[model samples]
Target: MLNNQKIKKMHKLALYESGEGKKHLAISNYYRSDYIGLALIKNFFLTTIAYGLLLLIYFGYRSEYLMENIHKMNLALMALQIIGLYIIMVVGYSILTYIYCSVKYAKAQKGIQEYYKGLTQMKKAYDREERRNGRITGRRTKA
Candidate 1:
């Protein structure tokens, strides 16, 4: 699977080298991704906001339902336990996001590098062809 991905990337670069289109890979890889960091920050903000909104909605409904646990959270056990659970959840989410982003960024860089490598190969091929053709004054080398 990984080999297939690499070959696909190489083919894409070769296409670019052949002047198929502007290199999207090079453009994307030019910038520092900070992909995982940004994702973690965004996730933290979103998760906290979502949890806060849920708390608000629960309390608002509780006022109507007239429940005993009006403002309390369902921590279940001790404060330490709740904190531990929160830590674990956040850490797990962070790890998953980091892995995803890292893979994407690395792949992007890989693709662009392959593209440049392909271009180098293409340049060499053209040079050799030109040398062999001897279209102008130079004598063609016998194949």
Candidate 2:
């Protein structure tokens, strides 16, 4: 959404000042609001899917040989070999996805904070201008 900043800027510029314009402004306002950022969501969901798939693949393959032989100790070592590589891969990717999620989460939070700060400043500016224009201007700032 932040990546669409230029489009947002242009949209703000093409103000028709209708009720539709107000709704559009509200939508963009929330888009840039301090609620959620796209990157954090993207990474978290992607990592979740990847990790889920990895687990499913691991357990599915493991089940093939072990379901019937679960209580059998004779083929334990053989099962371990087949399952060990999957474990290693899952662990590695799990760690990687964790690191990625952490970074993306922080980045998204920073973006939200910055966006809210910017929105606050904008509301202040708008209120000041409205006051100058002799219009009621105390709603957002009072919040």
Candidate 3:
């Protein structure tokens, strides 16, 4: 015979493995997507900063070379071009990341809703079985 603790544990496990479990899993996935989006954004920011610093260093070296060789290099125009390129790259990457993460989060939430609906159906079926049988049983009795 199943003990009270065992029965309770089984019921809990059953509920956890049902639609409720899916909902919990989907919530976790949603959080994970947020974290991933944050990481992506952070990485993009760091990379852009690094690229800007490198560009500045390169421009410094190039300015000295241009001063020694070409007497009329347009330093201001070159700097503006580099800054504009960096801004464009960062904006494009941010937009792409936002779209990808939004899609991922939406899909996760949809999965959670589907699981919740499945659990509701399962409960309804269990209730109907119990009502028909008068009590839940592990085995059927032959008439």
Candidate 4:
């Protein structure tokens, strides 16, 4: 005895599992705050590395000027300016990462909720089939 409704639901579930379900499951495993925090940490490190590379390129381009002005330049002020720029870059990127991760986590949780609802429906269908076949008792108790 094959149920068309059950078969359709099963097909849908299979498609989801093969596609976005993997990402949704992985995202749902983490707490919202934890996910956002992890993203922020990664963002910080990436920003730091990018900034370092930019500094190296800038110094390379100005090598001749820097060498000529080495004795005349205000080294302390220049260092302060570079530190300030790095701080700004890191803070800006962290804020964006936090917002993006928060939204992503929320969406994933919503998807998992829907998936669970589908599973519940499938379970009920199986119970109904069992009752029709006289394989079980009067009522099906949920666990």
Give the TM-score comparing model 1 with the true structure, all chains together.
0.54
lDDT of 4 by residue, 15-60 (tens): 8877998999999888888888888888988999999999999999
Against the true structure, candidate 3 reaches a TM-score of 0.51
Candidate that would win on lDDT: 4
Colliding pairs, model 3: none
lDDT of 2 by residue, 19-109 (tens): 3444434444444323234434554566567767876887798887768767765676766874686566556655665566455555555
Q: Give each prediction's root-mean-square deviation over alpha carbons.
A: 8.2, 10.7, 8.4, 2.8
Candidate 1 regions off by >4 Å? 1-33, 60-86, 133-136, 139-143
lDDT ranking, best first:
4, 3, 1, 2
Q: Give candidate 4's TM-score.
A: 0.89
lDDT tens per residue, model 1, 95-131: 8877877777676667667666777775776687667
Candidates sorted by TM-score, best first: 4, 1, 3, 2
User: Each model's C-alpha lDDT?
Assistant: 0.64, 0.55, 0.68, 0.89
Mind giving the per-residue lDDT tens digits that candidate 3 earns over 45-143?
876987779887986978778678665767788779887988878877777777776676666666666656766765666566556576455555443
**Clashing residue pairs in candidate 4 (N, C-alpha, C atoms within 3 angstroms):** none
RMSD of 3: 8.4
Q: lDDT, candidate 1, residue 141?
A: 61
lDDT of 4: 0.89
Candidate 3, which ten residues in sequence have the lowest lDDT sum?
134-143
Model 1 residue 99 lDDT? 83
